[model samples]
Target: MDDELHRRLRIEQARALLDNADPRQAVMLACDLLMAGVNGDAVVALAAESARTLPAYDANRRLAAVIDELGLPELDLPTAVALIAADTCERILDCSIPAEVGTHRLYVVGYEGSPLDHLLPEVTALAAHLEDDLGGRADDDLRTRLGALARTILDRLKAENPA
Candidate 1:
């Protein structure tokens, strides 16, 4: 599909999900946009719009949390996290599944990989940084597990796009 068409579809899908109070769906929709070569700023803007329209909805909150966790200066943290976690797991699942499926829907706008895929490293790094910031030390086994996971992800990325 064309970029404009894909973006419109994503926005429409996102709107429907947000209207249903599905924050996870909103996040996934944002991710799909990112994967489709939508600008990060645009994706963030769409997410912000969803949050604004669904102020009382939990999905709005969760999406805000993810945005905050991404360190976007425009987003608030605690409030977003609270909103996201308010819903039960089942509701979260409903929001998440579509987003997960939509991940594969990419467009050849520029880069060869999904922006979300690249953010995995940033997520892991942030987790480690937070662990250190909180003075919460992981056991050796946990550290090993995390390291292994990092290496696995890196290896996969490297294999997929050799330098």
Candidate 2:
């Protein structure tokens, strides 16, 4: 096969592995792609997008591992927050994850200096209530608030992409 065809095949395989959320295989293939002269930014973007399909903790952990393997800088606080927010919102809205679990993950992730802190006052206010005890004990009020925030983030993302 030509080099371009071979590269395309590898890219397709990487996408398939990522879609399956197989962290180990995906990262290994990402490394291979990098070694083969694929763009690092593209690989990182693909890895980050795939991480969203996982549970919050798992996604963060897996993405961190990928960054480490790629010799990238540590995952910054704001980026981590964004990833967790996007994951929490997407999973909750799709009902793929329970509201309690999603909120608990959000509570754990914390908003801190995230873009949400500046862009969404509601998130900062909500962050005040996010204590360690919020896991199984999350209230309906928390769920409703989180759902609203999730919709807002998703809508914003859609507007930004619009593709």
Candidate 3:
């Protein structure tokens, strides 16, 4: 696909992931969008929206900082995903959220009464796919891999949800 078309697809995927309350998927989608060179504003908007929906997610803060550093109103998908991975790394090393219950807590925070609650399962499934795709990939290739994964996830989500 052309760069513009790719960016648009990334944005749409990001928005869908956010609406589905899948911050992880949204993060991946944001990475793809950034890799595609979508406007930073669009990226930031998706990050902001995800942040708004999941206030407890620290990844959102990192994404916001990246957006500011890039001097964009929002972050693109690639940048957003990178920020998320960084945040994940920090959390893993620091044990910030209490490893025993962090995943459970995140699930509760993400799906509790949210309009996108119904998508939580799909998001979890997608995250698993992303984890697999990200394994053994070089840093520079991360964005490309994420972009492809985002497209696959979006397609799967659409097929299941059909809207």
Candidate 4:
């Protein structure tokens, strides 16, 4: 499929999922990806639009927290994602996740031996989210901006060993 067409398709799928207020993991994942900077304002808007329609229950309390966090004006999604990537990388150096899980996640993205490969999942999720929601409407620089974020996160690593 054409890149643009694929992007549009994902956005539509995500939007429909958001608009319907379904109680499911797909909706939750979409919202989380959006929070992580998938489609930016479109994800934000669609999430907010469907908030009240979301089924009210104890299970939804977690969703409520995510939705509430998204509403905060102080959080910049791209920067936040970069910060998360950097923090997760640090955690690996610090032995946060069990070694097996960490390696699998990192190896999936960092096959080129790039240190910042762990950011791939979040970035991939962002791209997936971007594919559907505002992705179709994204400016030419969206990819560039996202790439810069990954670079920015990597820069913060500042290897003390100096290779």
The lDDT values for all models are 0.40, 0.54, 0.42, 0.43
* Candidate 4: regions farther than 4 A off: 1-63, 66-71, 74-77, 104-154, 157-163
Task: List the lowest-lDDT window of 10 residues for candidate 3.
Answer: 100-109
Task: Please give, for residues 73-161, the per-residue lDDT of candidate 4 as tens digits.
Answer: 23333333333345444444555653333333332333334445666676565555455655434443544444454455556555522
Error of 3 at 70 (Å): 11
TM-score of 3: 0.24
Candidate 1 or 3, higher lDDT? 3
At residue 71, give the lDDT of candidate 2. Answer: 64
Lowest lDDT block of 10, candidate 1: 101-110
Ranking by TM-score: 2, 4, 3, 1
- lDDT string, candidate 1, 1-163, tens digits: 3655443343333333333334445655666656656545645655555534544355545555444544544413322221222222122234442321211121111122332244445444535543565344544444444445434434444565475
Q: lDDT rank, highest first?
A: 2, 4, 3, 1
Per residue, candidate 3 scores C-alpha lDDT tens digits across 62-130 of: 444444544545544443333233333334345563332222222321333343345457445444444
Candidate 1: which stretches are off by over 4 Å? 1-18, 45-163
Q: Best candidate, lDDT-wise?
A: 2
Task: Give the Cα error of residue 92 in candidate 2, in Å.
Answer: 0.4
All candidates: TM-score:
0.23, 0.43, 0.24, 0.27
The better candidate by lDDT, 1 or 2, is: 2
Off by over 4 Å in 3: 1-71, 100-163
